[model samples]
Target chain A: MRLMSKPHSARELTGLLKAPTGIVGFDDVTLGGLPAGRPTLICGAAGCGKTLFGITFLVNGATLCDEPGVFMTFEERPEDLEANFRSLGYDLNGLAAAGKLIVDHVRVERSEIEEAGEYDLEGLFVRLGFAVDRIGAKRVVLDTIESLFAGFTDQAILRAELRRLFGWLKERGLTAVITGERGEGQLTRHGLEEYVSDCVILLDNRVEDQIATRRLRVVKYRGSSHGTNEFPFLIDEDGISVLPITAPRRNLAVCNEIVSSGIPGLDAMIRNGGFYRGSTILVSGVSGTGKTTMASHFVNAACLRGERCTFFSFEESAEEICRNARSVGLDLHAHVAAGLLRFEWARPSLYGLEMHLARMQRDIETFKPAVVVIDAISAFRGPAGDVQSILLRTVDLLKSSGITAMFTSLRSGASRDEGTDHGLSSIMDSWIKLVDVEENGERNRILYLIKSRGTSHSNQLREFRMTDRGIELIDAYIGPEGVLTGTARITQEARDRAAADQRERESNRRQRQFARRREAVRRQIEELEAALQAEEDEEAMLLGEDELRDATLKSDQAARAIRRRAAE
Target chain B: MTSDAERLDEGAQEAGEDAGHYYLRLYVAGHTTKSTLALNNLKRVCETHLAGRYEIEVIDLRENPQLAAGDQILAIPTLVRRLPQPLKRIIGDLSNTEKVLVGLDIRPKVACP
Candidate 1:
């Protein structure tokens, strides 16, 4: 019961009760959603999804928030509404069967009945009152009540009755959603906007440059402060979702957690181990510039760190992305199989940019992934002006949620977008631009970091090569013709090798000459020492013979002297 | 489902209630000055030429707004002739008696230019 119970007041209460619509990010913009138990008027032009938004509110009230709802439609048939909402997972029929919801279609045909005298709208009141009592609904939705005005000719009576109906709903204290058709000058065709003094929401469907976008704006909210900006909304299978353009960017909680950019070399280029956690990474390049490859590295790294990652590929299918990543040694398929990585692929040409954003937010909220990758945002075709809003909301949502996001964009030319016009390049915490440089009759991918906020990044244009072994980053060989890559890089390397070989050969020849000179000098010294030794030996022999002759003479003299002394 | 708050008083059912072969229906939005003026002007024209021969039905558009589509009443204070083999729709307050007479074909004299 607690699981399905209405969420307690998450924001500070100021004596106003707020009912959350459960629409994506709507409560954030509305401050706390619609004023609780008060009739809120939703008006829009045709095909603006006014009725669908009302239905989503009622369905969410009945299903998620455990508030039984009553859906009284004047425009669409009950069967048609049920069938249309089935795609959104709202089982209107089942809810009606379970006595949790009431779906009543008011059908008043002119030919079938006649009036003769004065009367009031007692019959309709009875029908609506009966349905409300039957379902015990706390939330009510009167979808497109303005259609009843077209049937009635007396504006005075219809306006009076509409005001009475709103007052009665408020008296009942039921959260009611009243949808109306937009008029030229007035908010509603019947001028029934008087009753919407509590809250008024306007939905607009605009088409510019062949792209259709649905925007929701809160024209007025009496009791609470609400977003005044036009928020882009999307209608998908789940239902209507509004993307609030202003995502509490200023007060967003920042962390010191460092996350990898997937490439070790690029990580080294950044100040931290990689990028700041929950930072937005913009990877832009021309076609086949390995933008997706770099994105894959980021995803692969996140998965390696045991963090959940979701990759949204607009141009490639899951299978194609898997196969392509495999070619570059990124095992994304295994990560997907392990449930650490999620892949969502959609063709950008098929859906509006708002729907893509809603689907992306839905995926993020459900997957609760730590990292999200949007590959190739340039392919998203829309009004060049409107694309900025979509991109801003996307980045803002991810950033506020503390989810690190990597967005890859394809460039039409050699220059990179500074994101000034597109609102993308400006808010990014880091930007890595991949460019394809033609060298030696081949295109080589070059990775360059244009900017990294709060981090010191390498300014070198790293030579990035994708091979079966994996993507390898090598120090660029700057030759006389500038930084080289591919075969030209190899050629520069070979030329450097030949130059080193020549220097080594020259040094070896000089050493050999020195060794030969030393050998010749040693032979000369040996011949001189032999001549000097021969001269010294001859002198020593002569001196020794002279000494011997002297010694013999002295001995004979001594003998003669001794014989004379003995005779005396 | 269609029972309450509707009074369908047909000439055949209400006998002797302004006995006439012609059936007239006047549609008005509540009791406004325009609606009262149109009703008074229409009765004066009908009584003059079709006294006790026509049955007039006053239908309040505010009571049964759905009935407007049946008679194709675009503007309030409209007079519709349902009988005499031809359908005629006249709109406005019916202030000009001669014009109303000519419009209803009450007399050829009033109808002539």
Candidate 2:
């Protein structure tokens, strides 16, 4: 045996090629579901719809592929299986009667079998082989093989028999679905089955927050590029449908027609027109920087312009968005009521990224929105894995549909650079960076037109103030100290202006004091001169009088000696 | 197929209700030590405390080869519980006893004897 092994150079490729399971929409998740001519194991706990899933595979093969199938049930009676599927609109009885489907129930009871002896499974093989040949079955399902183990106690013989049975099935090149009951720490009760099967799919039924959900995941597929995420699958009347959680197809065609950004000033900043009609725009900023408000403004603007818009809000409720938009001076309620704007609030993990994209695609195709706004794409980054790939695919999908897409991402710390968050910066055709600059003591929001592809954009950071009138992008605040930081800059500038006014007032006060002193001195001089003139007049009068007296007394002895001086 | 007297002696020797002791036999072909270690370890364990309760019957197919047909053994070193009613057989050597006891339906003692 050792000499015969020789590493078996004839390699059997198990996992690269996928056989299309002719189930509509099922191939999207399994990536061309199940391998043909190989046995696949479907393992799950009780009531996880493992049987329903298996039956769907058979029914789908018979109806869609025009291929006959055989379903062997160890647990349920054949009549019971037929009746249960009838509600789902499957005509199993008709198919069986028409020789399109063959269903067999192998009854095994441990109480009746006393001998644990070796017996050829040739009877079972013969039955299965005959059924396959009779219906020309391309697909076969064996529901639950654990009953065989329960019926027989000889583990040594049973193990070899199981190996032989699997080998026999594979040798026949029959594509088969084998269901197994999940065991603790083991893929199945007899764990050897997983080793023999070409593919293994795990179905899970869980109740989270009272909402029961059935999820399907490909545990192992020997030869195909199968999606590895646990996808939510619905088992309705039509059978099982798995939601594929991956990026939708991206279309790279750039749209040139300009559209309003909702804010007239904002539109002016990003060229004289606005953002391209179908390009993706990133509006990133810190908390309370009006990212959602901006998204709402865009939605409202689009609606007012008579274009349909979808707002996928991750954080806020639709009611809150509408109510808050009014405070920002945007009335979105009218647009919502008018059916121009649709608000869809979703938790990022509502499904995997691919399922989210598919739902969005469905909505977009149905509503045909001209603009799609994912309130903040960052919320989706956790489950979406790689950020750049998701954003690129999303942008491509939107652009391909000619729908303008706007995504808001919240940046951590103080950096306003677009390059901060991984590779998301590269995928955006336009980047609107909102920064909360701290200058002096207050915080002020500043919006900058970072990059707008194919259009001239304002390089200056415009100060945007949110008020009752809405978001107003004030003229770029250019001060002596350059662009101010936060709200403190505005207060500091105000303080400086006040201090300069105080200095000018002090100088005027000194000049007034000097002029007042000079005027008072001149007045005193004039008064003194008047008084001197009056005194001189008086002296002249007295002199005149003395002269008159002297003249009278000059004869009278030159009298009046002052008169004497005057007379002298 | 066997006499009632022989069946009685076999039943009396095997009927120690001590759940911890297991009478195990690993059927294998030849001097493969995987089988020898399984036999030696089982005997060493029986000598320690289950000297009375446990018995290991190691069947070598190279010598008493037809004995393999009695148990219908396929894989080597297949540990078989001869005393237990729902006779349990585990295909490897008793490398993992937790699986062995669970497979053999032996209620494990809180502390090994």
Candidate 3:
């Protein structure tokens, strides 16, 4: 945010008195560019791209920045320089024809040339003036200023002439790049930096762990606040681009956008539907934990959303990956055919990590993809610094351009933490860890949402299965006893059902016993009723016998009959 | 190429074996006074001790200064023995005949001590 709001006044303060090199990513570090209208000394050992730097600066100034340049080389011929640069896609001859650039090859054969008395390099000055005037050039490049010294017999005069030459370049109002050979104790072979002191850039090419990295640093830049650290640079077909050693300034405008995870129910794990747009994600897991499958899902999802996606596969070939995805019913090949998906397959051992990064950056810039997937970033095995730099530049390039990137890495040893070998996990906006859990003689894949920035996410471990349809995150089996996986989960489900049936049968037996007791009570009530009726009948018969015995007794019998009737 | 280099080496060996046939290379900046004097003095000494049995090559460093690196030449008007098995260099205008002879690895006849 601070970089985005960099005060305009600050820019003008640092930028007013400078000449932009027009080399990609270099001008920013030089506080605008090289010191304007002054000679800058560039010294390096042989084969360290010293000449290439000078020529590129001139070519860029002429073609891209609309500043014509004059290039005077001391060693190689003009045709050789033109041919060499032609392969780098810079047309020196074409630029010369267009009157924008001039290449003068200064040949100094001592046998052919003579050094007369009382000379001060007026011939060289005249030639340079002619070339500069012809092209109306504002930039000049002297590839290896020492070749001229080798022809002259007097060192005192030669060094004095060199100092005068630099002063003349400034007086002529030209931004000049002077190349020199690195010496043992001093900066240059002849200590040329002492003569040209306006600015100095040091280029170093060293091989570490059998891998080569080229770095550049500003030794001295007069009157400017410039980056002093050594920045690694890339030399490719398109020329040179020095990647600053510092982390990218966070100035990108963030958007509240999301892209879904192709697997169903997976989006819910990351709370706000999916990962934050233009964020870096680290997908770390053990071997065969479906890390590659997860990457396929992300790439496929981006493609399905009609957004372009590029897959950098260091592990499997495109064919092998497509076949693996097809087994899970993901049509990766269809997306490739639809021009929505692109695969960059290369072996990690082929080049240094920086070269791989340069290639990746070039591809991403050309493809303009919305998402990029690196299948197994751990495949780049090198010095720890190399690995860290690879991740830094990759992350910076993706996030600053509003492109989300997913990097998959394989975790070795028994450590299940998502900590990367290069410690890049700390910079990740979201990290998803996959583990293979073994229980009851079966192994199941489970994934965890370790952390996601700017969004809520589930911390619960989700048991995932790679079915024929696709990758599915099923609910973890929480049983009465414990959380189970694979065959143990199935066995636990069967045991629970049997226990429910046993409780149902025990309740039925108790209800049957209550019904039997009710039947016995009903039988006893019936017997009591019958006994009461018999007693009443006996009394009636006795009363009838007494009435027949005498007339006088009739009244008693009638009374007994009336009593019996009342009882009935 | 190996046979050619061997033949050249053998030829140098033959020249050293030939008595009084000295092979010399004189380094000079140009046709200056010091350079001409050094050449004349060397020719006179070689003719007296090894008359008509010596060869000399004068190399002007000013005209072909690149050759100065091949012989590791430092000062102008220096004399180098080209064909001797063990080469020798004598600086200056070769003014003393006795010293020049001694520097050329030849013992000068000590007259009276």
Candidate 4:
């Protein structure tokens, strides 16, 4: 049956009406930009990196867009602020000295203040206006406005003042950043600041399994289109960097060049060559089924072809792998010394998944290797959250870079029909199954090619032995008792054949004994008759019955010899 | 000519007696556009209506910055009425005169026919 596809519909799009927030690289997610010349409140718990984000917005504006900024801090002094940003390689003090930045601190002490019936925010406006006019500051940050709540008891007055402050900023066409402490069930401590501002951002700091991760999400942005996903952010020596996990990716052309499997006789079954270059191959099997052996052989073959290869060893250390491969006639130490192979071992939980991916990308970009091997992909499945997505993206990345990718996965049981843990079979270009079958009282490893795209591979599962010289594929076993299992089968078969031969030998002996006994009986009868005749002759004349007697005696002697032979 | 205490008492009594007038204190960091505009607007309103009774104090926070504690001033160009009970605060340059006058509870006198 044929299926019908749906049609597309067009809708009217309303663009942003507020002043644009001159934040670099941030516009890529915010479509056009943030509301222009309007207050945007950024509220989060303390140490959630809210302050860093505020500083980043201002620094980015000053440096990238040539827009001057005004930072009005209520908690930290200007010196402390400058020192904090200095570690990020941002010269905030220099920018202030150069007249491109303005910093103002409003010191409010609750102990020194008296409550009155009516109040005004005229002093704050004057300071803000002075800073704005001094450098023509287009951006402003009022960090932790909640500090005012501690000095005042009247929420009504504070709310009115906040509304007016936002209105004033809008009137002056100056984009502003107002920061506040987050409150339970509310966006900010005052709860009215979010409504007064044009945009709101929430920053969260979470620790899962002793690993800290910071995330930022745009709660609301009026008159602007912004990404709503929670993007992971990092705070290092270089300030704040947000990684948009769901950003649109660029499509790259994939190459399909056939490459050898690095093992003789195995490549002949696979399309007269082997796996295509830039394709991902999954080597799945139970424990001790020669998965690592096959991967090592592939690496050795790649090295033999003078191609640079990288092996990411997660299950085994580099030295252990090298030492173990020695039994299989694979010497990796020489290849490593010759700069043909590199082995890197790291724990999957060493960092966040994105950080690990970024590190891998950096390494791949730097090395530009022709082949990459991730020994045992099962080790990376759990730590990376969703294994399928990570593997898919990794395959895409390697394929686009024209690098052959090989991964090994350990199955759970002895049955070769077991599926992979991460469900990578659907995407991998080739799936090789290795099994340990019990045959003839010995456990033998058998290798089978399940599928290989763009190539013809051997369909038969052949017996393979690990000898001192390396892996050797023996002829398939053909027997009436079917495939043998373990050494007991072979021992039992030998015992049954030996018993049958013994019974046949016993029957032949009985037949020969019967024939000899029958001949002996006939000879005995002749001797008896001769003896009787000799006796009669002796009685007649004591002498001359000799011929008959002699003949009978000779016959008796022959009979006696035959009887002895029969008895023996 | 008078002691400081006496002068303060006299000013307080006079401020107390003027119930119809709105006593306003503008806390500003320095001479800035918002501060100037707020001052000019308040002066114009007082002169036109409560010319004789109104008292407006312009306090520059930078000069006597410690005075900001007397009234909680979070932003500059903040206009506070101290004479009125349950003090009111209006933030901005007082550009919206109608809203600012209404917010300050100051109404112009109407002549009877």
Q: Considering just chain B, what TM-score does every model have?
A: 0.77, 0.66, 0.81, 0.74
Over 4 Å off in model 2, which ranges?
A1-38, A42-139, A156-175, A180-251, A303-310, A326-344, A349-370, A380-403, A413-419, A436-444, A465-470, A476-568, B1-113
Candidate 1's residue-wise lDDT over A1-568, tens digit each?
Answer: 1121123222323567888899887888898778887888899889999888888887788878888888888767889988888888889999889888888777544432332222345345555666677678889898877766656555676677777788788778899899888888988876657766678999998875566768889998765788898887878776777876554566777888999887777888877768999899899888888888888989999999999999999998889888998998888989999999999898886667877887788788889999999987887887777688778878888987899999998877745544443668778988888888875678888888988899888899988888886678887887687888888888879989999999999999999999999999998999999999999999999999999999999998999899999999
Which candidate ranks first by TM-score, i.e. highest?
Answer: 1
Which stretches in model 3 have alpha-carbon errors above 4 Å?
A1-17, A110-122, A245-256, A278-280, A310-327, A331-369, A380-403, A416-429, A438-443, A452-460, A476-568, B1-113
Better of 2 and 4 by DockQ: 4
Question: What's the i-RMS of each model?
Answer: 10.3, 11.3, 12.3, 8.2
For residues A305-401, could you state the per-residue lDDT of candidate 4 as single tens digits? 8999889887888999898888999998999999989987767665555544544555566678899888877766444446676776677667778
Worst 10 residues of 3 chain A by lDDT: A1-10
Model 1, DockQ value?
0.03
What is the full ranking by lDDT, best candidate first?
3, 1, 2, 4
The model with the greatest lDDT is 3
Better of 2 and 4 by TM-score: 4
The local lDDT score (0 to 100) that residue A552 gets in candidate 4 is: 92
Candidate 1 lDDT by residue in tens digits, B24-64: 88878778887888898888878888887787899886676
Name the docking class for model 1: incorrect
Which 10-residue window in model 4 chain A sums to the lowest lDDT? A1-10
* Residue-level lDDT for A509 in candidate 4: 94
Stronger candidate by TM-score (1 vs 2): 1
Two-chain DockQ for each candidate model? 0.03, 0.02, 0.02, 0.11
